[model samples]
Target: MRTKVAIIGAGPSGLLLGQLLHTFGVDNIILERQTPDYVLGRIRAGLLEEGTVSLLDQVGAGARLHQEGLVHHGVELAFGGARHRIDMHAATGKTVTIYGQTEVTLDLMNARKAAGLTSVYSASDVKPHDFDTDHPRVTYVKDGVSHEIACDFIAGCDGFHGVSRASVPASAITSYERVYPFGWLGILSETPPVSPELIYNNHERGFALCTMRSSHRSRYYVQCPLDDHVDQWSDDRFWDELKRRLDQKAADELVTGPSIEKSIAPLRSFVAEPMRFGRMFLAGDASHIVPPTGAKGLNLAASDVHYLSQALREYYDEKSSAGLDGYSARALARVWKAVRFSWWMTSMLHKFPDEGEFAARIQIAELDYLVSSKAASTSLSENYVGLPF
Candidate 1:
């Protein structure tokens, strides 16, 4: 079988690319390692930058998002027994919404299917063919038999663990990486939010965050040892720690009883240079990984797709490869900005026990100054809310 484009991984990047290609009257197919239900049900990053929301609307996938998303004008930076708001609207003249990634994915899926496109799920062991040639293909096993789908090119949106990157020679890809000393163990509770805006707190005890996933659901996180396990903490202990770190004001705040789900996320910064090789190109987490402090993950992926989609559209319609040729370095420009912003935010907050008392005090002092100075707070808010796609 063959297609104009063969995309790996049905995550946002891959799915959105397929939808964009269809908009340009190009035919494409997407292969995902996860089941459709799983991909649709996976609850992850929800904050969509204004640019990303605009892309969704242009691609015909914003019906559910525009209706269900909680639009936020700013986030609260809490430290030193006080809470400060970094007004995003005032800083960047932009807005971000508290819509989960799952909502966006479902919306994309519905729009794609309505436009007569289907994604094959549970497709494991995807192999990119002819990396050095202009025409390449993706071969994978769907159910019981192996199949090869030839295509003009392949988009490796399979994320960090996917096989497309592995297909490139080790010598050709230069990777830069740094692993942090701590991780965020977050929980999703079936309760109402305690605050109007997202709260990010840094205390000697730990780094904690309070935010809402939806009207009826609250999302919370706290710093833990990099190797800490979720089983180490109980439901009661979770709420207690959150309240202590957050300094809950109301008695009925965060009605935490059942611990629905918990996850540990390691902090890291990863980037692979030259995201393209012959017929295969990388997009999304497949090329870079940023700590979630800046809330840039989903937006970055969407931005990469927006560029890639534009490039592919130019190549197919105008018979010009100028846009396609500029994909990597162009995407890298924004990627590194986000990488730096995420690292900076992570450093500005998160207390490090290994650094001793002096270092911890210095971190607090810096946070104090950052929030105290309007210019500094503006920089933080601009970086946190992000720029155009």
Candidate 2:
């Protein structure tokens, strides 16, 4: 098969890119190693920056999001037994939409199907070949048959552990990473959220986040040892532990329920430099990862797609290679800023194992300053609402 672009993975990045390219009059095919259900089954970040929502609107997939997604103007930071609200909208003139990543994938998937686009799910052994030359193609195995797609360019939207980045020669890519000592033990419950807005708490016990998928379905997380297991945290135990970390007001108002989904995710900050490799380019998790503290994971992917789709459109419409040539540096600039923000939030909100009383006191002081000073609050609010795309 031949196409203008061959995309790897059927996750939000790949699907959104395909939709955007199709809207831009670019022919593209998506290859996925998992089924459609599997892709939508993955629960991910629920926060969407204004820029990300705009991209979805551009692709005509924002109808459901606009109708169902909750918009938050502020976020609360709880520390020292009190909660301080950061007015994100007042400070940045922007707002974030609380919409699950799964819903975004579903909307894009439906849009792709309605447009009769090509997507090969459950394909195995997918690989990109000859990306260093003008001619680049992708190969995969499906239903015990081998296939190859000849395309003008290849897009690696797979993920951090995907074949897209793994295919690259180690010497060609420079990687920087830091794995945190703790992981987040999260649970999804069918209960009303304790607070109308999301609450991020920094307590002597650990870090706990109170977020929701909807008004009735809440998602909560508490920091735990990296080696902790889901079985070790029962529903009652998780609720009890969460309450212990919350302030008196939130603890009193918190509702407990049976957990429908629970898992532990280790925190890490990673980036692979030079997102472009000849005719093939990496976007989204294929190039970088950040701790979820600042809720930048999915938004970063959207920004990468924005830069990439624009580059491809320019290449086709104006026959210009400038955007393509500058894709990596441009995307990395935004990616690094987000990485720094996520790291900073993680550091300020989470209790470190080895960091002694001095470090703890410093964190308290920083949080105190962050809430008391308008400049610091505005900075945090701007970053939280997202920087300009």
Candidate 1: which stretches are off by over 4 Å? Answer: 248-252
How well is each residue in 232-294 modelled by candidate 2, as lDDT tens digits? Answer: 999999999999999999999999999989999999999999899999999999999999999
- TM-score for all models, in order of appearance: 0.97, 0.99
The numbered model that scores best in lDDT is 2
Cα lDDT listed for each candidate: 0.86, 0.96
Backbone clashes in candidate 2 total 0
Q: Which ten residues in a row have the lowest lDDT in candidate 1?
A: 246-255
Per-residue C-alpha lDDT of model 1 across residues 153-183, encoded as one tens digit per residue: 8999999988989889999999999899999
Whose TM-score is greatest here?
A: 2
